[model samples]
Target: MRNQLLAVLDIVLSARLVNANVIRIAEEAHKAADPHLALALVSARGTTTNPVEIALDLEMLDAAVDCAKEALAEIEKIKRVVSKNVVELEAAPSLPGGDAAMRRDAIQENLDEIDEGFQICGARLQEMETVRDIADKRRKALVARV
Candidate 1:
């Protein structure tokens, strides 16, 4: 239970970091583009797109990857704990008949729960990887243009 709470806190902190990075990226976008040129483009045409925005968006993607890394760390920690618990339970000697059965049941329940959590975390990590791949492609395109 305490570990779950800590994981939640870690996720929240990571999310906050992502948000801050997004704001920084937006600020950078403005700095990278010439305001006069942007204004002229806006005036002449209905819409103006800055290449800098794509570069900044790539930075934002990196930030998101960082956040996902943090979450992955927490998930790894949880997995380690689960492994340790399983080892301890396995090493422990079985008590009298009924007591042994109860202990086994409890251990199995805990292991099941941990396994479920692990699967969820693993899926999310995979999703983050996909996003990172897309970000890499975007970065390459932006770099080629610049």
Candidate 2:
């Protein structure tokens, strides 16, 4: 369980770092190009560039940032839940609140939840790759033109 938790943690952190970098790049684009002004200029041109294409990339990058933020929150919650469980697991059970069977069941349940969270986080990180691809393509197109 600990190993699996670590794997999930690593995945979440990596994705978050990547997305955060993407956001920074977007910020730089906004600064360097005045993306809003560029969008307006493209709109004024009327037929040269498709505004929808730029809009889609912007929207997806926004969603990706939000998803990364959510993943971070889930990672924190998982850490706290597991930490609490570890503490409880280490305590010596006294006169009848928790028997061996109860403890075993609790441990198993926690493990299962952790694994499920692992799957969810893993899937989110995989989706982030798609987001990165979209962003990279859009960014490269901009660079090519400049």
Candidate 3:
């Protein structure tokens, strides 16, 4: 579980640096285009750059990932727990049409639920990745004095 926690924890923890970089760069980019936006970014960057806030945001992100992972773990545990009963129910020797079909339906439903959650998480992660990549390139350009 601890190892699983660490693995799943990355969804939030590592993403923070990505998100921070994104907001910082995007804000700078938006601001660079205009005086008013730059002014707004200046205010936002200050709050964002604060050490306390940075740490808090990072922890919050990690916790969100952890919660998601915890829920996933629970589902997996549930699948395992019910699997035996599922097999027995579906495999009953006297049952008509077979218990396997019944088990299949249950498993399919559980899988569908898992797939839905995973898709949402995947979309969010992809957005973060897109933002981070843009931010990195922008920073590199600025550093190059471009």
Estimate the TM-score of every prediction.
0.48, 0.45, 0.40
Judged by TM-score, which candidate is best?
1
lDDT of each: 0.48, 0.48, 0.41
**Residues 7-100, candidate 3, lDDT per residue (tens digit)?**
3333233333433443343344323323422222333344343444434443444444344444445444444543444354444433335434
Error at 32, model 1, angstroms: 27
The residue pairs found clashing in candidate 2 are none
Ranking by TM-score: 1, 2, 3
| Candidate 2, 10-123: lDDT as tens digits | 443444454344345434433433343344334334433443565554555555545554554555555455545545444434324444345445545554555555465556
Angstrom error at residue 1, model 2: 31
Return the TM-score for candidate 3, rounded to 2 decimals.
Answer: 0.40
Weakest 10 consecutive residues of candidate 1 by summed lDDT:
39-48
Q: Which stretches of candidate 1 lie over 4 Å from their true place?
A: 1-49, 142-146
